[model samples]
Structures are given as structure tokens and as C-alpha cells.
Target: MRQRVQIEGRQLEVSNLDKVLFPEVGFTKAQVIDYYVRIAPVLLPHVAQRPVTFTRWPSGVDGQAFFEKNSARHAPEWVRSVTVPSPGSSRGRETLDMVLLSAVPDLAWSANLAALEVHVPQWQVDGAGVAQLPDLLVLDLDPGPGTGVVECAEVAHRLRDQLVADGLDPVVKTSGSKGLQVYAPIECADREHPSRYAKALAQELTRQTPEEVVWRMEKALRPGKVLVDWSQNNTAKTTVAPYSLRARPLATVSTPLRWAEVDALRGGADPESVRFRTDDVLTRVAEHGDLFDVADRTRAVLPAV
Candidate 1:
């Protein structure tokens, strides 16, 4: 099934509206497009200025999925994009032309392709289309065996305290899968500072609680502890954008949270309470706006490490 729709003065022809993308919850391609369309007001700001790498699930979550970074080939001419240096390009291309989903129509177009996940770097592009210094620092709290969202919340609180002490205001969000991510707005002079600061902070946390936290990614060392994944702060790496839907069995979203919610989770709230789906997130934005807005508006320098 396909339909023609007008969004933000652009015409988009979306297909497979009845195709099931999340069989567990009966979510269809239409629902996916609708979610992105309705959530565009809040979702576009954080992603508009940066190049996006979409994770496409054309055959649904139960089937094969792939990441699409160079999208200029098939993107509509009306859809804007940016060209940025790609140092790790295996294709031998010096730069990648990535999609910039700056408008509601862009979201609809991507969703029509079954792109369930949207990922972007911490930095935005300058006026001349060059990559700028990272504007935020992130720490992915990945729980190992015997630990889960509750454990991640506990670590997030600790990270919040340390980030606060370092003069940076931090926020927390669910990873939309199995963990949590802590992000703090930052002002840095170069590209490497966010990654360095995140690594140093994770090391400090590990030092303070080696029994509960592990900074390294070794699978053997992860049992019963949360891994502070500081590597996502790298300029070349991308974190899942807040409010973007995860390609999980239940259509969970990488929803942002208030500090109070994090406190409640650590205070014994059910882990399922933090797993928000498409409708739940729409309701949240209606009531609370974007909880992750601070990450876009506030900036504090990364204290010398």
C-alpha cells in the first residue's frame, strides 16, 4: 500500500503502509511514518544541523538491517544534505554525503524506507559545512549479565554527580534497547576533548567502584556491572538520537528523561516503566516537551582532565 502526502510543502509518496515492522506489537510501516511525522517538531532540532546515518530495517526488525550513511544517491533533490570528511572511509571516498532530515517531509521519506533508527554525531556542521567541535559529551551505561536498566540508572546518578562537580549539567536517557546513556552539554575548543573527557570520567567512576563499573568493553569482565562506554564520544562515532525509535521487538524509543524520573528508577521503579513506545513518547512530548532540550541549549566547558 502506498499514499501521497503533503508535508512541509513537500510531496512524499510513502509505501508499505500496512507492512508489519514490529511483529511483536503489530506496529506497521504507517505507524512508523506517523510517529516520525508527529515527533518532528522536537526531533528535528538536534538532528537538523548534523549529518544522519540511518539504520534501515526494510524487512522489519526480525529481518536483516543495515546502516546508510551516504544517502545522496537516491534522496529527493528537495531533501537537504551535507558533505563531511570521513577519515575512516573504507570505500576510499574522502568524504560522505549524509542526509540532513531538517523537515517533516524528510522524516516521512526515511520512515517510508523502514529506517527505524536515527544516529548522529555529537557535533554539528559549521556554516561552511565543516565538522565542528563536539557540543556534548556522552557515556553509554551498558549493563552486562545480571544487570539491566535499574543498574544503569544507579550508575547514571553517580555520573550526574561527578559531571555536576565538573561544572557540566548532565541529562539521562534510555538507550531504547538494553541500557542508558548520560549526556552533558559541553563547550570545547577541539574535536578530541569530548572523547578524552568522557574517557577520563569513566575511568574515575571505574576507579571509585571497580566492583560495579567497568570502563573496558571486554565481554568477560562485564558480568554484574555496568560498562561505561565512553567511546561513542569520538568525532566519527554516532549516538542514537533521543526520541528516535529503536528497532527492538516492541518499538521502544530512546526517550529522554527528567532527573526525577532517573531518581525514581533507582529508587525501585519497575524497569519497564522506562521503556517507552511510540504512543507513550508522543504523550510525553505533549506534556513535558523535549526533556533533552538542555543538551541543545546549554554548554559548559570540559574541565581540564
Candidate 2:
């Protein structure tokens, strides 16, 4: 049921590799591991030194699923892990230890769990065991019924414009679902908080385009608008790390999009213009390199509150 895979010099246990994950596409566990192996060059940078959360589908994507936060029990001893206080664990006194994926073996082993979706917090843990400040602020743009990625694309453009005006460079990506997420790297000594700044920006952006953007999470307000989920920037919150494969029936990936692609969609491009699958993503990296390299940008500072 399980096999030891030797990659480079490290070894990993890959099990249930023939099991189908995406029934419609016949995607299997083997493919999942391969995807991670191929995407590691681009993904490791984003996930390195950050705590990881796993959404496991042991049987398959259509089967029952569970989330795993602590990986030490299942992870190899060589894997790097850190424990941080749970979101509000009695005022942060309690803590939970988790694996930090920094290499190919870490990812391949995680793939064995059918972890189709991987999420990570914005903060990185320092060797001193402190959770450092968030370097990236993410805004999740989720579409409601009657709207599509097209609408989300438009909203993303407007959001990007607003962020640029604020002196920050933001990158847009398909959520690998029917939504989009924008990641902006912010660095400013004047503001040490991420949640407050992200929330204020989302609310302000909603005010500028009330008809198409909804900052509140109320369902009734989402019909024709993209929900600007600023809450993802909270310290305890997590967003799907870039290059993560979404647990979709279609085996889609949370792909980084060049601003031109988003602009094209808003200008009448087809829906698949931004949608990418495993093969498509590998090819993309081969040609364009890592498009999300801006995620490490530290030059643009957030405006003081």
C-alpha cells in the first residue's frame, strides 16, 4: 500500500498512489506527489519557515476529509516544525506544534495524506520561537452565485489599483476555485499590524466600488459582488499557499496570474484564460518562471495610519 520514494537524496513514504483523487480527471496520489515535486522550486519559498495546515482526503477528494495542524506525529523527524499558540488559546498561553515544509521530501510525504489543499499563515517563526510579523497581506475575493471569475477579475483590478496607490505592489492569483486572492507584501515601521491595515483597506475599496465589491461577509450582500475577505490577514488566519492544489473536482491549482491575464479577462477573455491545472502550471513555470516573485518584495512600505 505504501512505497519508499527516493528523491534527490531524501526518502519518503508514498502510499495509496494509485488511488483516485479527482475522479472526473482520473488524477491520482502519484500525480499529486509529482505536482508538488515539480512545483517545489516555486512553492518552497512561500511556505518555508511557516507553519502548515493540511486538508486531508485520505480516501479521495470526494470521500470524507479532515484537517491536520500538527504534523510531528506523522512527519519525519528531519522535517522542520514549530509550535505556536493556537488562535486564542487562553490568551495565547497554549500552543500547538506543526511541521514547516521547506523541501521536496516534506511536500511529497504530505501528498501521501491526500492533502489536496495546504494553507499557511502569513507569519514566519523565528529560531527564537517567536511568530514574526506578517510579510504578506492576502485579500480573498470570493464570488457568490450569479457571478463568476470575470466579476472577480474586475474587482481584483480595482483592488490592485487601490493597493498600488497605497505604495504596495500586489499579486493576483486564481483561488483554484471560483474565486481570486490578492497578496501584497507590506513593510512599514509606522504600522506593525496586518489585520487592521488590511481591514481598513478592504472597507475603503468596497466604498469605492460598492456595486461590485462587498467587504462584509453577509450572504445577502454577495449576489453581484466579490467578497473582499480581509479577515484572511488576521494573525491566526490562513490562506492557501501559492502553488497549492485546490480540492476541486477538476484538479485545478491555485495559480499565480500575471496582471495582464486578469486585465485580459476583464476585457472579454474566456474563463479558462486564468484557470490552470497541473500540467499547465508546470509548463507555466518552465516558460515564465515564478510569477509570484513579488511576494518577497519589501521595498514598498504601507502608508502610516
Candidate 3:
């Protein structure tokens, strides 16, 4: 089923509203559209200047999913887009035409297409359509087998303290999957500063606590440890955008957190406590407002390790 809706004066045709996107909770495509629209006030600011790469799961969470970096050729003219260089494209294409979801209508369009996850790079495109240097640094803490969100949270606290010592203010968020991602705003002159800073800190943490932290990406080396994935800072890599839905069984969101919440997780709070569903997140926004808006405006230069 398709229905024409007008949002911010932009009309869109949303389809298959009744189709289930999260099978475990029976969350439907219509609910997904509603979540995106209602969350737009806070979400759009974070998404505005960034190029979005959508993870579409037309067949629901348990079914097949595919990543789409290039916006569809048939996309509406009103849908904003930007072309960015893709040196690692397997298709041998020099660039990708990515969607820039700046408004509620753009999000509704993506949700209609079953885009369950929204991913964006640390850097954003400038007014001239040029990809700028990264304005933020990220450390993706992923727990391996025999580990979970609690372990990741513990590691996040360690990382956060170190970031504070270095004079940068870092924030925490759930990956909306099996980990926590810590991000800090940084004013860097070039592309390599963020990645280099993250690698140094990850290595430092690994050295200080070899029993709990691992910086490498190799799966075999990660058992019983939280991998501080510094590689997501790469220009080619994209992290799941804050507040984007995960393609999980329960439709968890990549929700931002107050450090107090991370502290609770470290103090043995239930892992399920961090897993927020669509409705839960809406309530959270209503209560707390955007916890991550500071990261977008605050900036500090990387300090030598």
C-alpha cells in the first residue's frame, strides 16, 4: 500500500507501510516512518551536512539486507544528494552519489524504502560539495565472544577518562548492536589526525589492560576482550548514525547516552537496559532532549599521545 503525504511542504509517496521490518516485536514500516519523522527534530541536525549510506532490509530484520551508497536514479528531485570520492569502491566507480537526509520528508522517503539503518562518515560535505576533513574522532568498542555491552561500557569509561585528560570532551553511545562507540569533537587540519589519535589511545589502553582490551580487528585475537576499533575513523569508513535503527530482532536504536548511563552499565546494569526500542527512544528524547548535540558544535585539536 502507498499513501501520499506532505511533510515540510514536500509531498512523498510512502509504500508498504504495513510490512514488518522488525519481526521480533512486529514493528512495521509505518512505525519506522513514524519514528524517523518524530525524531527528526533532533536527528536531522546530526544528519544535515553528512552523506548517508543506507542499509535497506526490504524483507524484514531476519531477511536479506543490502547497503546502498548511491541514491537511486529515480529518487525525487527534492531529495538532496552529494557526490563524494570513493577510492575503495568495488564497482570501480570514482565517486558515490549519496543521499543527504536534511529534512523530515527525506527521512520518510528512506524509511518507505525499508532503510533500516543509516550510516554516515565522521566528516561532511561542504557547501561546494567537497568532503571536508573529519570534525570528530570515534572509537568503536566492540565486545567479542564471552563479552557484552557491560564490557564495552567499562572500556568506554577508560577511554573517556583518557580523552578528558587530553583536553577533549568525548561522548558515549550504543552501537545499537553488541558494542558502544565513543566520539569526540576535534578540530584537525588534515584527514589523518583523528585516526592517528584514536590508534594511539587504543594502543595505550590495550597496553594498560591487556586482559580486557584489544585494538586489533582480527577476530581470533578478540575473544573475551573489547576491541577498540579505531579504524572507523578512516575517511572511507562510516559509523552508524546516532538514533538510526539497527537491523536487530527488536529494532534497537543507536541511541546516545549520558555518561551516567554508561556508568550504570559499567556498574553491572542489565545489558537489556541499554537496548532501546522505537517507542522507548521516543520517550527518551521527550524526557532528556538530544544528548549528543554538543559533539556537533564543540571542537578541540588532537593532543600528542
Q: Report lDDT (CA) for all predictions.
A: 0.91, 0.85, 0.89
> Mind sharing the TM-score for model 1?
0.97
Q: Model 3, range 30-111, lDDT digits (tens) per residue?
A: 9999999999988988888988889999999888999888874547999888888874853778887888998888999998
Pairs with backbone N, CA or C atoms under 3 Å apart (clashes), candidate 3: none
Candidates in order, TM-scores: namely 0.97, 0.94, 0.97
Of candidate 1, the 10-residue stretch with the lowest lDDT total is 83-92
Report the lDDT tens digits of candidate 2 across residue range 42-126.
9999898889999998878789988778666788887888878877623544777788898988888888878888899877889
Better lDDT candidate (1, 3): 1
lDDT for model 3, on a 0 to 1 scale? 0.89
